[model samples]
Target: MDQPEGLTAVGEEQKVCRLQRSIYGLKQASQSWNTHFDEVIRGYNFIKNDYDPCIYKKISGSSVAYLVLYVDDILLIGNDVKMLADIKAWLSTQFSMKDMGEASYILGTKIYRDRSRRMLGLTQSSYIKKVLKRFKMALKTRSHSHEAWD
Candidate 1:
């Protein structure tokens, strides 16, 4: 690897820097992170999903938990609250992370939940609004009425 611009020494300009560890934004960083994460999570008996490599699931008797990984962010879902808390605590010990409480939004999608109805909904209204604003169409309105074809 070529020496970084500002850190290059006058006499050692031809010397290349060797990386000791994976650095963020590097091409191998994500792969390294995923490999390390997989090993740690698997140690806790979590099974990586066959369909999606980023998803892991742990089942113990009646308690079940699902962990979804998106880059550096993680979204945890489960029926048992206690199990989820345990997983969060374990994750905190394993890596530096902050609990953002319940997930309201992720990846431009909004999450809505109704405990009373036991319903969950996902929407992209925020994304749509951003796109409309980007093209200067935020205030534009279109007629929805339709007339019989001649």
Candidate 2:
């Protein structure tokens, strides 16, 4: 932590301070947090996905579970309910985790599932609208929206 303004001893003005551990406000803190999370999650026998380091998976017998992380939030999914619950409980013990129940959205995409058909879908319609609105280019009609594609 740098000395607070007006509180630093006269000679200390030229000196910089170093932190022993990363914290939220530091520039490198997010990297440190991700590294720590990876270590802890890997310790639970999960393997980090090669394509996406933020994703981890665990397998036991025929059951497979996935842990998707976006910063501090997590999305836990699996075919076995008991196994998912166990992983959630274990994660709570390792960190200050909160169970957010089932995930409905991720990365501004809506998630849809049909258990009977074993199908899953993701949509970003709402996200697109938000982006359009932010840029003051939101179309007033579906026709206008489609015309932009041409």
Candidate 3:
């Protein structure tokens, strides 16, 4: 805080400048942001997950919703559509955010859902391909054998 570059202080050089607001790039900045997020989410009646602090869950009557936080990214999932919409609207009003509509990809994994069958799938095919290409192994093909090896 000792007088930022190009800004000259008339007084002692040893005196550090006081910060008017929470400054970014500082260690406490992230902590403060996370703490504020936790407080806000808790105010919405969402409880933090025990195993992972970044996860929060809210259950209202028969509806259940979950919120996952990864850095600045968020992934929300819920059984009740109305509950999900309400939560999204509330969050948008509180913070500057852009809704990506339905979630298709998250954390390098692609999501597939079949509502009628009630099946959900997570795939990393694209990620695996990229990794393989980076290592020059993308050209390799898997060998298929109908005969059993004895």
Candidate 4:
């Protein structure tokens, strides 16, 4: 999220439009988008977290649903099993949303959570395998280091 070109308000007393490809951040784009999404979700009865603006919560009697937004990515949590599906439907009506369930691989790391054992794990085993195969080292001896060039 490096500063975008001409991103500063620059005391123009007005706003300007941007017409360039940015590094995932479009200056006020994130905030405006977030505000828009927050309004939509709140209209659907979800409450935005004051402490953590990225988190939105909804409570219905004993049931609760939580939403976490990271830029364009959203991870939802809820005690009700159908909450995710319901939210997905609602969000789809407002904006395009793709539900990535269970979060297996992100940024080359596979995430696993053991609910009964109360543990979580992040491993690059699949990533490493892909890297190995990419280098045509399928049968090469394994060394647990990326700095090994020889």
- Computed on alpha carbons, the lDDT of every model, listed in order, comes to 0.93, 0.89, 0.89, 0.80
TM per model? 0.77, 0.73, 0.77, 0.57
Over 92-141, each residue of candidate 2 has an lDDT whose tens digit, in order, gives 99998778788898889999999899899999999999999999999776
Stronger candidate by TM-score (2 vs 3)? 3
Looking at candidate 1, what is the lDDT of residue 59?
99
The most accurate candidate by lDDT is 1
Model 1 over residues 23-82: C-alpha lDDT tens digits? 536778889889999999999999999999999999989999999999889999999999
TM-score attained by model 4? 0.57
Per-residue lDDT tens digits for candidate 3, residues 85-138, read: 999999998788999988899989999999999999999999999998999888
lDDT tens digits by residue: candidate 4, 1-150: 334576755675365565465555667887888889888889999988899998999898888999888888887778887777788888888997677678776667888989899788889998888988999987665576855765
Clashes of each: 0, 0, 0, 0
- The alpha-carbon RMSD values of the candidates against the true structure, listed in the order shown, are 4.7, 5.1, 4.8, 10.4
Cα-lDDT of candidate 4? 0.80
**Model 3 bad stretches (over 4 Å):** 1-24, 144-150
- Clash count (model 2, backbone only): 0
